[model samples]
Target: MANTKSAKKAVRQIARRTAINRQRRSKMRTFIRKVEEAISTGDQSAAKSALAAAEPILMRAAQKGIVHKNNASRKVSRLSSRVAALGKQA
Candidate 1:
């Protein structure tokens, strides 16, 4: 239990921040999933567009400390490669 007033305020702030972070994480996942879905369908142009939309969201998540910067970069790189391969295959 947070007995001190400051402690209670801190708890409230934590709850608010947690909610915001959770929303951001969920949104980021949604964007990533869109790219994955596009890739799985084997539509090169759609995958490229989806990756374009997702890239900024992923970068923003990293910038905001929701995800590690290198992790985000790796994801972007991997997805870009997969999308590029689709073009090569077609």
Candidate 2:
């Protein structure tokens, strides 16, 4: 549908960015889920470890523009607080 060469190039670039962004979103979700799972199982150590693994990935997602920084920070904050609370609750 892109008759102009420039339009075709733009389409190609969009596709590439979309694919990359999708992968980043999926990975971020997976990491967050892992942290949540660790917390749910009531293992403070595992929850802490999972948080350690996920925090940087979330931050990197923000830095790469895949997600907003405040959104990322909020998620990280909530997750960290939840994980921290596991220690007290246990």
Candidate 3:
């Protein structure tokens, strides 16, 4: 569909970028899932540690433009709060 050489190159670049971004996004979700699983099991320490690990991945995805910055911050905040509440539940 891209008749121009530049357009063809642009399509290739977009495909590459899309693949990279999709990988990053999937990785971020995996990290988030780890945190959630820890939370659901009510293991405060594990939840805390998982959240610790997930925070950076989420932020990095946002930094790389895979997700919105505020979205990342909000997820971190919510997870932090949930982990904090685990302390009181014990």
Candidate 4:
């Protein structure tokens, strides 16, 4: 239990921050899923476009501390490579 006033304020702040971070994470996942769906359907253009839309969101999430920067960059790299491969296939 937070006994002191300061401690109670910190707990409230943490709760608010947690909700915000959770929402951000969920949004990031949604964008990533869009890219994956496009890739799975073998639609190179759609996949590329989805990746374009998702890239900023992913990077922003990293910048906002929702995810580590390398983790976000790695995801972008892998997704972009898959999208590129899709182009080669067609």
Give the alpha carbon lDDT tens digit for every residue of 1-90 in model 3: 999999999999999999999999999999999999999999999999999999999999999999899999999999999999999989
Q: Model 2 — which ten-residue stretch has the worst lDDT?
A: 81-90
Task: Give me the displacement of residue 39 in model 2, in angstroms.
Answer: 0.7
Across 5-78, the per-residue lDDT of candidate 2 in tens digits comes to: 99999999999999999999999999999999998899999999999999999999999998999999999999
Clashing pairs in 3: none
TM-score of each: 0.98, 0.97, 0.98, 0.98
lDDT of 1: 0.96
Name the runs in model 2 displaced over 4 angstroms: none
Model 4 Cα shift for residue 79 (angstroms): 0.2
Best by lDDT: 4
Predict model 2's lDDT versus the native: 0.95
